[model samples]
Target: MAGSVNQQQAVIYCRVSGAKQVREGDGLASQETRCREYAKYKGYCVLDVFTDDMTGKAASRPGMQSMLGYLHMNASKGSEIVVIIDDISRLARGLTAHLELRQSLAGAGGKLESPSIEFGEDSDSVLVENLLASVAQHQREKNGEQTSNRMKGRMMNGYSVFCAPVGYRYEKTAGHGKLLVRDEPAASIIRKAMEGFASGRFETMAEVKRYLESQPAFPNIDGSIRQQVVTDLFSRVLYAGYIEHEPWGITRRKGHHEALVSLETFERIQARKAERNLAPARTDINADFPLRGAVACADCDAPMTSCWSKSATGKRYPYFWCQTKTCGMYRKSIRAEKIDAAFAEVMHALSPAKGLVGLVKTMLHDAWGQRLAQANTIKETTKRDIAQLDKQLDGLLDRVVESDNPTVLW
Candidate 1:
């Protein structure tokens, strides 16, 4: 129904399911073309064209909100105003949205029109609109179901359904589609970290974190790798070439990607982890000084801490200082370079020569032989104790068979 050509003004509204559809295709453009042609045929003067790239089932959208505000602004005007859409499904796909939107349009004093469906002010027309809205809602719900199913299927096929881990990056392979691949120094660093923990090179999760921070190539959050990040990396099965997700009901399945650490090594790391629930927690020490707890202050017999001193020239110099203020040498700054050189000298002195190394090995072998001889003696004593216990048990059984006393028999 066309109003007077000179008196009527209209706005075109269009929408698509998602931004991906808009970018990869022309869904919005095609919808606009169809609506414009229909508006021209009816002699309606087009005022503005508003568009949205979002689901039709959603009642709140950026473009739709703006268009509603515009409708309210022109509601009191005496001129005839109309809102045109490509189809009713483009306006909304849910029954609740359909009914609510119809009321909202009426309240704004705006009439709705579409090229495919004729607008009528009668009972039959309202029934037809409601039927169409119900059908659209069904389609929207069915599409959601299919999408969820596809994601579950992918997860079951040895592919990660979630984001990739630290050492792996996602890529689209030639024939494999999207899959995970090893990512640079991060991968090598993580491999060393895991293997270190397994071999006792790194004793605790804190040690693992320090190892990662030492590597410049490894990514860090806020200038350090968070404790949670280290904990998650240790627990992930992807490093062992497996996948497990609870929400999707997926259990252990071999992954398509290569593994960084061996399965046996992963088990060792888990076994070495501290029983946090039972033991008193370890206090976190400042990691800036690796020798913080190891090296003792010569003056006070207390551990020293590392810090920096700012000189008059505004340059910072590294120093090791005692924290105990009551000590005689408290706050005495020792040059870090001197301490490092002294440590190197001590280590060099401790290195054994070839002849002394052989001497030590011979002594170690004699000590081991003595330990084995001692173990044999202990085993013989243990066997004698077991035989005596058995003899005592046999005597008790004979007494029980011969006695009438209730105490002994019972």
Candidate 2:
């Protein structure tokens, strides 16, 4: 009977909370070692070792599922396989998950065994197991809370603790552990794009997207810049040398990282965004109908829509039509050829006469001269404003230096 008991089959199960532990720590390996030692001490035949790198609170784990299937496959009428673990927490962090896995293992003909705790059918043993599982759950939750608090504190001190946005990467600094720094050509490209938008050079978000697409160094998904990314860039204050986290109650404050654009430019970008005209370029406009949106519907004054219509005899005809539901000519189609000829006639009608070319040139020269004078006046005004702001900033800095209380100013 002793020899038969010693010949019982067993499998080892080990787990860690995350992939970082699996890659950088020996938690899983050490757990497996301790479990194998226990199995050897019990004289059980070790069949396999299963490991999972995931949270214990998770109901289903790939390694756990595989071990269960293996146990069911090898189980015989009178033989049961022993499942060995280093500790109960390695099995599950929560009482509910522990109980569910316990039932599943028993159904698969696996007898639970651990080096740290002895498994028994008694009510007292089940109570101890449940208490330990609950403790493990509390520990997991506590750890999460501590980590969040630390990150929030770091962000409060003008350090970004979250993942770095595009054009920036994390680098280890002397005082700051991981700090955001400009990441090469992509940063330069983004700086130009943002400044262009802030200065009204790129009038619309569609123009910005096109500009980004034209840059060879800019990162792209499937060889195209996404509209959503452009939108996010416009609203992110971090690019303006400030940090803000509404969820953590961190208000806008100066960050330690170098800024790509000035706060003034960022504010201007926001002001322009309020106009609510940052619509993306329509993908439907193609070479087949170059004047689709350029030409207005005479009936409704809305841009005409273009499509190819198939006739009963299987012939395709390109046409432009008004799509405004409230218009009288809502679905009235105009032949593409007729519209093209009419547009050509209009262009001819509006063409400048040869005799008036010199007069038009002189008028443009005068307008250019006026613009130069206006720009000079604006430049002088901006200089005075900058000097006043500098004076105010100096006064604020003096106050910060005189104050000894940390909580008061912050």
lDDT of 1 by residue, 1-410 (tens): 44464656888899998899988999889998998898789878777888999888878889988888888886565664688999889999899988888788777767899998887879999889888899999999998899889878988998876777898989998866789898765777798889876764454688778778877667886668788988998898889888778877999888888899988888877876743321112233344445544566898875565666799999988687776667888778898778878888998889787799889899999977855664664567569889999999999899999998988866
Which regions of candidate 1 fall more than 4 Å away from where they truly are? 1-5, 77-80, 162-169, 183-236, 260-274, 277-410
lDDT of 1: 0.79
Q: What is the lDDT of residue 330 in candidate 1?
A: 78
* Model 2, span 191-271: residue lDDT tens: 888987776555577878888887655778767988998999999999999999999899999999999899998998898
- Clash pairs, model 1 backbone: none
**lDDT against the true structure, each candidate:** 0.79, 0.84
- The C-alpha stretches of model 2 lying farther than 4 A from their native spots are 1-6, 214-216, 278-410
Clashes of each: 0, 0
RMSD of 1: 28.6
TM-score of 2: 0.64
Q: Where does the lowest 10-residue lDDT sum fall in candidate 2?
A: 277-286
